[model samples]
Target: MEPMGLRERKKLATRRTLQHEALRLAIEHGSENVTVDDIAAAANVSTRTFFNYFSSKEEAIIGDGPPRPTADATAVFVANGPTGDLLDDLKHFILSPMLDLSAEELGYTFTDFLARKQLMLRESHLVTRMMATFAATEREVVAGVAARLGEEPEAIRPQIVAALGMTALRFALRHLHHHGDTAEGAGAEGARAAEIAELRDLLDEAFDALRQTFDTAR
Candidate 1:
């Protein structure tokens, strides 16, 4: 990867500051009570600058930047041919973006959120906010799955698979946040690794259950 230029580094720093500040302010006050202007003020950036990075306060609060699959993941999806197990491929495609995250990056995002009791207390509200952000990503995943299967994006099968994949991901994330890393023996890195492993296990269980349900119904 190319090194980040000074300008890009500055932009990233500013965006991180805005995101951290936005979450802090939203947690201190209710999300409904916080405005973009308030977040910009807290971050010491102009409201215009905040808008340049994020369209709304919720985006800053979620703090994952944008919902986008990495280039390699996208390439893998596009290059995939008929594997006969569309559902399994769909699951892999859906999770590919997360697979690209480095261990440190995963810990920074998922583990940090899991550690925050305040965030957990507002689970419903946070989930609602995250859903809005996830909508576009869902569409993208659907398109990718459809393309891989030589079907239209609007096809019912692809749509259902995409939705189920996303639901599974959300369920796994929530479960991890609540039940992961409770052991006192594990260090922080160990805990994070365990959490990730548990997440994969949860996803596998969910998909297996789904497959079983379909088979039983048939």
Candidate 2:
């Protein structure tokens, strides 16, 4: 990776600040209620500058999130580290960058929103939109990974693996969000590391059980 100059670093910091403010405002006021002007004011950036960073208010709240990588970036990230095993590669590909989120970031974005949505599932539209975006982006990521590995992108197993991994991730996120803490509770996403671990373990166990059932049928 090329070293970022001071100017570039400053730009990124400003962008992050803007996104954070946008998210905070959206959580407080609802996504539709938080306007670009509001985010720009909160971040101390002009509305024009806010437009330079994000195309829409929703983008500001989502803030180039981990699950939605651009095609080129996803290709590069997938190709950089190639493990021979497909499952391990899938897990690494999906989970690595996610590990970078600060505890506060997770709390603000996910953990705090879990319970109300769990009971009401009122954010189904938001969830659907995010999942669709994630699926489309992740398909590109897997295609790049498959190309690098000399596997056909249309091959059944690879497609199935990608789909299953995505499902597990969404499930984990919803589980953590709904059950970890209500929007009013403390500890937020910071204290849910253990829960995350357990969710991952459950995914593995579920996969193992499916494998055994297939073996028995075969």
Candidate 3:
């Protein structure tokens, strides 16, 4: 692949700077107390520049908005016929975001931001607000998955699949966060690859266990 152009590199640097500074300020001061101007000043960029990247201070602190399947993943979902394995397809759909990410490209995974958010949850109401937002995001995921499956969003099967997929994702992320330091000795790329592999393994195990439980019950 071609290297990022100079302008693109600069924009990425600025965005990373903004995210780092926003998290730092939110941790130091309460998330409620931190303003767009505060984050911009901390990042040494104008507030206008911050707006260019993130619409809200909470978004800056959270690293980005809620995770969604990428367009490529969505296309794959749409193209998949009715005979495909729903669980496996959903797993790949959820995993698509982290797939093909080089270490340099993997700036601040959700686990990192979530760990920091836990620390700040004590003093700020942002965590509560974010949870509400996440619920809505989950609904959106349910709708997307339902559409791909040619079912209603509220259909029992689609809802169950979406909920299980999201739960597995969260479980994988938390597991990685707990075990992340095991990869600290590796090089950056190696560490990221290892983490992704570990997450996939954990997700597979979770899904397999769920399948077994249902099969045994039947």
- Cα lDDT of candidate 1 equals 0.71
Please give the range of 10 consecutive residues that has the lowest summed lDDT in model 1: 111-120
Candidate 3 segments exceeding 4 Å error: 1-13, 81-83, 136-140, 178-185
Candidate 3 overall lDDT versus native = 0.73
Considering lDDT, where higher is better, how would the candidates rank from best to worst?
Answer: 3, 1, 2
TM-score of 2: 0.67
Q: Model 2 over residues 50-152: C-alpha lDDT tens digits? A: 9988898876665544444334445654565445555555655666544545555544445433432442253454565445556675676568566656678
**What TM-score, computed on C-alpha atoms, does each candidate reach?**
0.76, 0.67, 0.79
Q: How many clashes show up per model?
A: 0, 2, 0
The candidate with the higher lDDT, 1 or 3, is 3
What RMSD does each model have against the real structure? 3.9, 5.2, 3.5
- Model 1 Cα lDDT, one tens digit per residue, 79-152: 77234476676666666665656554555556445533366477456776656666778888888878776799
Candidate 2 lDDT score at position 148: 58
Which residue pairs come into collision in candidate 1?
Answer: none
How far is 127's C-alpha from truth in model 2 (Å)? 3.9
